[model samples]
Target chain A: MSVDQFLQYLISGITQGSIYALVALGFTIIYAVTRVINFAQGEFVMLGGMLSFLLISSFGIPLIPSLILAVLFTAIIGAIIYLLAIRTAKKASVVSLIIITIGVSIFIRGFTREFLGVDSVRPPFFTGDESLTIFGALIRPQALWIIGTTIVVTIILHLFLSRTMMGNALKASAISTRAAAMVGIDSRVMALTAFVIAAVIGSIGGAVMAPLVLTSYNVGVMLGLKGFVSASIGGFKSPIISVIGGITIGVIESLAVGINWGPFTSSYKDAIAIVALLIILLIRSGRLALEERAD
Target chain B: MFGFVKNKWIYFLVGALLAVMVLIPFDWFMGKYNTLLIFIGLNTMVTVGLCLLMGYTGQVSLGQAAYYGIGAYISAILSKTYGVNPWLAMLIAAIVTGAFAYGIGYLIFRLKGNYLAMATLGLGLIIWILFRQLSEITGGPDGMGGIPYLSIGGFGFYTTFKRYYLVWFFCLALLLISQNIVRSRTGRALRAIHGSEDAAESIGINVAQFKVKIFALSAVFASIAGSLFVHHLRFVSPQPFGFLASVKLVVMAVIGGLASIWGAIFGAATTNILSDELLLGFGELDTIVYGLILMLVMIFMPQGLFVKLKEIIVQWRSKTTQKV
Candidate 1:
C-alpha cells in the first residue's frame, strides 16, 4: 500500500516473476518448435535446484562449480526426456502428447523422491545472504541473482534467436517445420536444441530459486503450473510477453497476500495464479479464434 | 423382447448378469472384496461419464475429480450439517454439479486441444485449493467426515455388503443408460462432432450444446459417484479427490477404451486394484507407474486395453480354429 511496502512487494514479485519467466521460457521454446507443452519442464527446474543442493551441502563442493554441474545435469535430463518420451510419441495426438509429458513428469518426480527423499532442500546463495536495501526496500541477494540472471538470459536468448544461424534455423522450424525442412533445416535437430535450451533455462530458474524457496520433489507441479500460466498468459508469442505475464502474476499474487483477505492468505496463493491462468487463457483463445476467422 | 434389449440373446445375457449380481454379495468368499467392488463401482460412474465427454464428444477434461469432490462435499454438507436425507442430498449434488459443469463447459469448450486440457487442469487445481482452504465447510486438509449412508424405505445400506449392492446397482443402471444413449441418435451426433466439429456444424448438429450437455452428464456421473463414495466410506476428504484422482479417472477411461461403456468398468476396476494392491506398498511409485502406463498405452496401443486385447483374442481364436 505505502511506497516502501509497494516497493517491497514489487521487488519480491519481480524476483518470483524471474523464476516463472525462466520456466515459461522453457515452455515457450518447446511449444514453438514441437507444439508440445512439456509438463516435465518443471521437473528440470526441480532437478536443477535439488541437484545443486546435493552437490553443495552433502558433497561440500564449491557453489559455482556445483551450480554449473547441476545446470548441465538438468539439461541432460531434459534432453533425455525429449529423446525417451517426446520423440517416441511423435505421431500421437495432442492429448496423448500431454499425457506423455505428464508421464515423464511423474517419473521424474518419483525418481527425485527416491533419490532426494520427500524433504525440501536449499542450495547456498550465489552470494552471501546479505539483504541489500534499495530505497528503503530490502532485497535478498539471491533475489538480485534471480532477477539479474533472468534479464541476462532473456537478452542472450533474444540475440541468439535473432543473430545466430542455429537460432534462426530453430525459429524457422518453429514457424513451420515443413518449410524449414524444405529449406534444409533439420526440424528434429532444432527441436532437440530447443529442449536443451529450455532445460538449461529452467535449471537456471531452479538453481536461483532454491536459495529463496527451498527446493523439494513436489515443487515441480506447482512451479510447472505457474510457468504454464505465465506462458499461456504471455500468449506464447514472445519470451518478453511471458516475462511480463510472470511478473504480473507475481505482483498480483504478492499484493493479494499483502491485502490478507480471509482464506486468501499464502494458502490460496496457487489458486490466485491459476485463476489468472484461466482468465488469460480465455481471453487469448477468444482473440486467437477471432484472428483465425479473419484469416 | 424389449426394444432396448432387442433380442432373445440379449435377454439371456441380461438374466446371466442379474444372476451374477445377486450371487456376488451373498457369497461368503466375496465378502472381503465388497469394499473394493464398491470403489470400482464408484469409479465406473465417474469414468463412464468421462468416456462420454472425452471419447464421444472429443472434449478433454482433467477436472473430473473436482466435480467428484464437489459432489462429495455437497452430499456430506447437506446430509450432515443441514440434516437433509442422503438420497435427496445425492440428487441435489448431481443437479448442482451438472449445472456447474454446464456453465464451465460452455465457457471453456471454445479452447481446443492442449489449451482445453490445461484449462481443465487449472480448474481442478483451483477446486482442490478450495477443498483445502475452505476449512469451515470442507474441514480443510483433514477433510469432512460422518457422512451418512444411502438408504431405501427406511432400510439403511450401512454394511459394506449392502453398500456394495447399492453402488453396483447404480453403476449397472448407469451402464445400461449409457449403452442406450450410445445407440441413439444423440450418440451418432456426438460421434459426428468428434469426427469433425466443422463438419458436424455443417450437418446442423449443435456441437456446442451437445458438448455442454455431455460435459454436464459426465459431471453428474462423478457427482453421483462422489455421493456414493462418501456414504460408503462414511467420510469425505479433499486428499483423495485431487488432480491425481482426475488423472487416474482419465487413465481409466483411456485404458478401458474411451468410447466403450463396458470398458469403463474394466478400466476402473483394474486401476483401483493396481493402486490399492500392487502399488500401495511402493508408495509414490504408483504415480510413476501410472505415468508409464499412460505413455505406453498412448504409444503402443492407443485403441486401449479392451480393444487391443479383443483384437489379440480374435487373432488367437482364428489360429485355434486353423489348428482344429
Candidate 2:
C-alpha cells in the first residue's frame, strides 16, 4: 500500500486501539487490586454507550453532561457488582470467583437487553460532521477525540497512582496485601476504588466508541475478551504496554481486513484477535521457561 | 443389604425413566414439534460430556461446540461427498473429533485458570471462522445441506418418531457410559484434580493424562451429538457451533449442576426449550433472558439444580422422620 493508504489505516487503527487500551486499562486496574479478572468490565462499556444513547436521544442532554452521567452510572454499577458478587465469593476458590464474574457478565447482558429493548441505539458523535485530511488520508474529528481522551486518561491515571496517597495504598495492596494491611491500608476500600476507576475508564471508552460501533447489548463479550487479550499481550504488567498492545492488535486487524487476503477474511476478523492472543501467550510461556532454565 | 437394594433400585428407576422417555413419541406427543425435543435430547448428549469435562474435571472448555461442529461437518461431508454409510460416517466423525481434541488438549492443558479458558475460547472462534470462511468445504455461512437421513435394517428413518427413537437410543447409551465413567477410578482422579491439582499430582495422579483423556472423551460425546444433529436436520451450519453456542453449552453444565451426569441433560433441555419458547416471542431479548438465568443460577445456586434438589429431598426426609 501507498504511504497515504498506510497512514489512513494506521490512523484508524490508532483510534480503535485507543478504545481497546481504555478497556484494557480497566482490566489491569481491577486485576492489580483484587487479583480477580473482572469479566464484567466490558459490560460496563456497553452500559456507558447505551446510557449515553439514552441521555442524548431520549432526554436531550448535552454530550458532555451525558458522558459524565453515563460514566458515573457505570461506576456505581461496577461497585455494586463488586459488593454483591465478588465480595461474597472472596474466600472461595479462584475458579469460583471466575464463575461469579462470568455470572455477573451474563446478568448485566440480560438486564441491558431488557432495559434497552431489542434494537441498537447510536450515540451522537463528540465532534459534529467534521473530517480532517492529513497527508491525503481523511480522519474523523471523533477519531481525534478518542485518541486525545485516551492520552489524557492515561496521564491522569499515572498521576493518580503516583501522586496520591490512596493510589499508593492501592498499589501497595496489589504488590503485597499483607504488607499493605500491616501499614494500615484498607485493602477492601482499595479494591472498591479500583473497581470505580476501572468502570469510569471503561464507560468513557464505551461512550467514545459508540458512534463508530453502535450500542448493542451483546457487544460486551467480544470487547471484554479482546481487552483481556490485550492486557495479557502487554504482560498485564504495565498500563503503557497495555495501550501499545491494544493499538498494535487494532492496526494489524484493520490492515488484514483492508488487504483482503481471501474470501472469508471479513468473517475471520474476530478470530484474528483470538489467534493473536494464543500466539502471544504461548510465546510468553516459552520465554518464561527459557528464563527459568537460564536461572 | 439396604445399600445393595438401593443401588439396584436406582438402576431400575433410571432404566424405567429411559423406557418411558423412549415411548413418549409413540404416545400422544407425536407432533412435529416432538422432533425438537429429540434435538434437545441430542444436545443433552453433548452437554453431559461438557459437564464431565467442566464440572467433574474442573476444566472449562469453550470449544465443545467446535468438536460438535467438526463431527457434524465430518459426517455431512462423508455422507454427501463420499457417499459413505451414515452409521460409519458418524463413527468416523467421533474418532476424528477425539483425535483432534487430544491434539488441542495437549497444547491448552499447559495453561490453567483464565488462560486456559481464553485459549479454548480462541480455539472455538478459530474453528468457527474457518467453518464460515471455507466455502468450498463447509459451504460458507449458508451451511452445508442435502445430508441423507440415517437408516438401519433396510428401513429409512425419515419420520420424526423414527429419528426420535434413533437419537433417544444414542442418548441412553451415552448416559449409561457417562454414569459408568463418573463412578470409576478415572472419575475419582478427575475430582481430585478439580479439588487440588497440586495434591492430585503429589498423590500420583498423572494430571495431564487424566485431563487429556477426559477432554477426548468429552469431544467424542460432543461429536456423536453433532453427527446425530446433522443426520436429523440434514444440514450443518457454523452458526449452531459458534462461540455463543459454546457459552450456552457451558451455561447448561453450570445451570444443571455440573457434578452430576444427568445435570448436563437437564440443563441443556431446560435452557434449549426455554430459549426456543422465549426467543420466538421476545426476539433478541431472549439472549438477555439466557444471560439472566445463567447469572442468577451462578449467584444463588452455584451448586446447581441437582444439588438444590438433593438438599430439598434431604430436608423433606428429615421433616417426615421427625413427624414420625
True contacts kept of each: 0.63, 0.41
- Per-residue lDDT of candidate 1, residues A109-210 (tens digit): 887887789998877778889899999999998898899999999999999999999989988998889999999998878888999999999998899899
Q: Candidate 1: fnat, from 0 to 1?
A: 0.63
Q: Which 10-residue window in model 2 chain B sums to the lowest lDDT?
A: B283-292
Model 2 per-residue lDDT at A278? 86
For model 1, the stretches where C-alpha displacement exceeds 4 angstroms are A262-264, A290-295, B1-18, B322-324
Residue pairs in candidate 1 whose N, alpha carbon or C atoms collide under 3 angstroms: none
lDDT of 2 by residue, A1-295 (tens): 7899989988988898888888899988888788787878889889989999999899999988999999999999989988877776677555556666776787788777777875787787787857989989999988888899899999999999899998899889888788999999988899899999999999999999998768798888888878888898865668888888888888887777777767326677788788888888787866533432332
Q: Pick the candidate with the highest TM-score.
A: 1
lDDT (10s digit) by residue, model 1, range B75-170:
999999899999999999999999999999888888877788888988999999999888888899998778777788889998988888889989
- For candidate 2, list the clashing residue pairs, or say none: none
